[model samples]
Target: MNRKKLEALQGWSFISPALIVISIFVIGSIIFTIYISFHRVNLFTGYYEFIGLDNYKRLFNDTKVLIAFKNTLSFVAVVVPIQTFLAMVMASVLNAKIKGVKVFRIAYFLPTLTSSAALTMIFMFLFSLYGPINQIALQLNIINEPINFLNDAKVALKVIMSMNIWSTVPFFMVIYLAALQEVPEAIYEAARVDGATNVQQFFKITIPQLKPITTFVLLMGIIGTFQMFDQAYIFSNGSGGPENSTLTVALLSYRYAFGQNSTMGFAAAIALVLALLILVVSLIAQKLNKSDTLY
Candidate 1:
């Protein structure tokens, strides 16, 4: 046995446990999901009959699936950038050495650290028919009647979108705050001395310096929003609301997999499609970030 070969063997042995864990949880689950997608299975029986492309075909033809896809895409498209921009703005303002800065930072970040379940519950109360929101609107004479924030299909999705933004903003704000602190103060000072306005300094100096962190936050936001299930599930009581306006791919897959009408194969197929969608979005986000790099 050569000395170098023995050293290599020892290194592999040290990492073998972690590698095995990853393979079992990550790789094994992926392979199982793919395998099930190509089969016909259900909860009553463990029987998995080989049925290649059948699940995929049905998935594409399913109207509910299509709506879920559309809703998921629309939510991500509208939410991610808006949340990121808001976070950046908040982070920039907080970065300034203003009075009571620490208190302000804590106040802004409280929501990020709070439990999602609690936040969703509070939102439900706020959006209830005769809740504070409607009361205020009535007092202001904005409407002749109370609005059903989660019942109107036309506005249900938008309401969810707004809630999602509110829930996610504080998290991204923390990320942006950390990134902003890492940015060189000298660069912003120089830009200001060159007659650059605050907005210009932010655009030209802060943004460029924070590209790497911004890219990270963007990627995380996409993945998180893509798999958004908790808030909608809680707020809508897992029904996805009146007209399925708040239906999401993750929630749909969960419904199919373990809910009342469990179709294991179809559920697996949904999971596979969602995985592909996330992979494509992540790749595109990375590509766009890389292409637009200043450094």
Candidate 2:
């Protein structure tokens, strides 16, 4: 073989294993899921009856699906902005030349290292009726009575939101911290020379420079919050109870896919819808942020 052809063949051989694995697993699974979404699948009997768009149609008419979508959207809307803002603020604080800064950074990042399941359990305990949160509120006259955070429909989802924000902030904070290093000190120096205050510099210089990182953080937050399941599952014990306040679309899809009365076709449909929703929302967010431009 010619040297050019031989190099091309060698390069293909190097990538062939990964291509084969991806083709058989990732691509294969997606194709199978699309096929199953259009069928009535019976796993036990190995039966698949083509049902056309019936499964997709059922999603719109199902009240649980509606509730799930509402909850997921609320989660994404609230968590993404709050977490992104908090991450940026915390990153700025930690990036300063303050004493014991390393300790503070480690303390903040510890929660991110912990598993979501464990964090959920910890928050559940902390927010329990007589936990420290209630006790502190009671002592401070913030509440007349200890609130039942877990079982109360009004607060159940909010409690989960708080937990998610707390745990995720540290991760995105680290991202912002890394991005902060890339920001030119010369810009901040110029701002200071222009008699700009710290807050002014942060808003005008730091924030504008970190626009790309903020976009990344926002996208990650949106995707993560939309697909929230482990915390909700552990919080509601897989029932998404308390009037379905904590019922996320991901948890709902899991229920349909593996519950006692499994409906694989509907589960597949829900999963595909979620993937499309994420894609559209992400694209819109990217467009709005204009992450392609630095300024």
Candidate 3:
């Protein structure tokens, strides 16, 4: 072969393994899921009876799907902004030349290292009736009685949201910290010379400088919160109980896919819907943040 053709062949050989694997696994799975989503699938029997758009039609009519979408939307809405803001603030604080800042950073980031399942359990304990949270409230007379956080429909989802925010903040905080390092100190210096306060510099200079990083963080947060499952599963014992307050789209999809009354086609449809939802929302968020132009 000619030298140019030989090099092209060699490059293709180097990438062929990854391409094969992705084609067989990722692309193959997506294609199969799409196929099943239009049918009634009986996996054990290798049966698929095509049913057109029935599954997608059911999505709009199903009350559980509605609840799941509501819960997931609320989750993404609340957790993304709060976690992004808290992560930025914590990153800024840790970036400061304060004593014991390393220790504080380590402590804050430790929660991110812990598994979501473990964190859910810990938060459940903390928010349980007569738990530390309730005890403290009782001692401070903030509540006349200890609140049942886990079983109450009103507070169950909120509890999960709080747990998600706490655990995720440290991860995004680290992202912000890394991005903060890239921000020019000279800009802050100029701001200071211009008699701008610390808060002013943070708002005007640091925030604008970290726009790309914030966009990344927001996208990650939205995707993660929308797909939240393990915590809700562990919290509600796979039932998404307490009036389905904690029922998320992922968990709902899993129930349809694997529950006693398995509906594999519906599950696949839900999964596809979730993927499209994430794509649309992430694109909108990216557009709003002008992340493409930030760089």
CA lDDT, every model vs. true structure: 0.87, 0.93, 0.92
Give the lowest summed-lDDT range of ten residues in model 3. 286-295
Q: Model 2: per-residue lDDT, tens digit, 191-224?
A: 8899999899889887888888888889899999
Question: Clashing residue pairs, candidate 1?
Answer: none
| Tens digit per residue, CA lDDT, model 1, 130-230 | 99999999999998899999788888888778888987898898888877766778887888888999999888888887787788788898899889999
Superposition error at 16 for model 2 (Å): 2.1
- Please identify model 1 stretches exceeding 4 Å from their true place: 1-11, 290-295
Question: Comparing 1 and 2 by TM-score, which wins?
Answer: 2
